[model samples]
Target: MVMSLALISSCQWKKKSSKAMRRRRGGAPEIHLDLLIEILTRLPGRSLMRFKCVSKLWFSLIRSRCFSNHYLTVASPPRPPRRLYMSLVDHLECNSMAVCYNPRESALLLFTSSSSSSNNATSFDQDLTLPGMGGRNMKLLRGLILYIVCRRACIYNPTTRQSVTLPAVKSNIFAQEDYRKSVLYFFGHDPVLDQYKVVCIIVVSSKKIKRITSEHWVFVLEPGGSWKRIELDQPHIPTRLGLCINGVIYYLASTCMSDDIIVSFDVRSEEFKMIQGPPLVSAFKPIDFIEYGGKPSVFDHTRLRRKGLVELWVLEDAGEWSRKSLVLQPCQMHLVNKYTKWKVKGTTHNGEIIFAPLLLCSPYYILLYDVQKNDLRKVRIRGIPKHWFRKPDTNLFFYFEFMDDSESIMHLEI
Candidate 1:
């Protein structure tokens, strides 16, 4: 409906702007651009996207940073995004060695709540297979999702259903299998600069050759944006994707010396720094990255098996932390296997930590662990795509990535 109105307004505006341009021709536009922008900014995002094509003038107005910033702040903050998106991938039961779950098929699944305040099961909406060659490294910011396709990255505005691929960095490593094994990606937005950026880390393997090296690169989200390579002296294998908060991206990276070491990259400065990790850094142990009270944090999956206790380690300073332990209730304990391998999917904006079992030993359900109450509740998600649990080839298990993200109307320059 908003898009329809935006289209209607653009048609009307085009008629007016045409005469204004003809009247001024070589002079000032009869319709002041500032006045025109003010009126357009009030329209829905869907309308604005269509209006961009009305004329070069309208295109520049909608894509300008000044206009986007104004549009973002003009309205009351969007009701905290209840829309949830998840990317699920599980290996098939095919003969011989297994193949990658089709990156394009059943790659992304979305669900929307039936009401603003209801706690009942969520209703499934739609599924989207991101464009481009379809590579992993999926991250979302504001309302734009950053994903890699064909070894190159791209920004997608799901609100507008528009996408722009990032320019590929010139390199020979993309052809090497070793490079694929140690690649990590982080997508962040700098509120200070109102800019969206991508941080790519590639760790060179030593056992494959010798003397390993790690490289970093930054890609600004804009037209003609290219990867600008950065330098890093130490080598670390990234275990999970980076989490963005307050313009910084943090993730657990393992050095040969320690598994708790965290590597932080300032999205604006493009600099790398190290911070002390919480005590439980061990090899082969899965670390669930989360956000607690708006600070980056992590918890051990190992704690769950020990009487259903999970310790949340939140980073307060570069090398400091505030720890809190959440104990699962007996009723919650009965919901799933007491010793099942469970992983933290994410922390909700309302200060809740979400978890799901690695193996579907129990029925499909998500545990919402409340931080303040230390209680767990189940959010049963319905309408999951059929492909999600259908393991035609392998019935052993199905693994998926669960993400709790926000919805925004932020427009992309591309």
Candidate 2:
């Protein structure tokens, strides 16, 4: 009986393996294992996920770490999966999102991990209403987003439609000191360790005592993750979301609130360092922190008379920075004159700067400036739900644009 069962199992395994391999005949009629992997790696993200059911051998190969790395490299050979999401907020705090990827509609977002869910291809533009996630402080790294809050954190991966809400972080030893106030959270990843980390900086200020204290805590994402507190001596309070590169996190911070300094934190070492900001900085002027050509760069709009020019400062090393100036052409300046409250929205990995306006009207368009060619082009985002702008001036709207190009399949592991 045991021998018969063993033979049956062996036959089943052979049958599965045979279906997975496509025997190709050449001059030598060689088995195309490398060719098979090459073809599989070039397939679309969803197509590869669906092809796993072809056989047990195929399923294992698709899910293996080796195959995952190869597929990721192929997908992002030169250009990664670039996705854009635009969020608009009105006077009454009502928010709407513009997704820029779904076919015949806006982009994709807000997925759920339902066992019976066959609706993998979801659309967020169909509905003008936004998610219940409160607060404006958020970070988008790869396809995952962390809505930073000391009280509650919403960590979500839109690619796999998986989400986990982390518990509220403990603020300080004193019960009266509310850690939620002035809470700044930065989401970063250590590519070397393949880990996602959330750095929380909570500023607990007391008016009666005339003093302020800062607390730092970190949360690393894993199967079972928890928050660990770190000792901090620096008095910097970061003002914006950090840009994580390699294993370092860089964000704009301020010690006196009059001038801003760059804060660098190593995610792997859990150490903090400060870099001095450029001179002649003002809050009224349009300044933005962007990743330019794989390094931390700043975009400053140096306004002169009715015309303005943007300066791109790229860091060559820790001590040196290269700066480039951008001025709009005659026709591009004409379009810019009509826009109000426009600012540098984002910068792509290929050094294309995006401009978005926070106007209270429709038929909105964004500007894209190429650094290499020194040319600017405007692209209008269409497919917004009709009901959002149909109300006319009854509702005021302001838009913020974000792009994610870090395409990785690790999110689907859950």
The prediction achieving the highest TM-score against the true structure is 1
lDDT of 1 by residue, 1-414 (tens): 444544545555454446566667643334556666666666656656767788777787777778776776554232234455554434332221123345455245353542422464554554433312223455656666665543456666665676676655565554554522455568887888877888877666656334445678888877667788887777777777678888888888777677677778888887888887877655357767777788888876575655777777888855688787777777667654665667776766577766776654324677777878877787776655555565542433322332334334555654
Candidate 1 residue pairs that clash:
93-393, 93-394
Off by over 4 Å in 1: 1-14, 17-43, 50-59, 74-81, 90-106, 109-117, 127-137, 149-151, 173-180, 206-211, 359-363, 392-414
Tell how far residue 53 is off in model 1, in angstroms.
5.8
Q: Candidate 2 lDDT, tens digit per residue, 1-414? A: 333432333334344323234343212233356766766665555555666666687678777766765665675343323555544322232111222122112212322222211212213343433344323354677666666322456676554445677655675433444332466678787877767788878675554324556788888876577788999786655665678877889887666444457788898888888777666554235687878877887778656115757777776675566778777677667656543667676675567777766553457566677777877776665544555464444433333435465444454321
User: At residue 6, what lDDT does model 2 achieve?
Assistant: 27
Q: Can you give the lDDT of residue 5 in candidate 2?
A: 35
TM per prediction: 0.78, 0.72
TM-score of candidate 2 to 2 decimals: 0.72
C-alpha lDDT of all candidate models, in order: 0.62, 0.58
lDDT accuracy of residue 366 in candidate 2: 67
Best prediction by lDDT: 1
RMSD of 1: 5.7
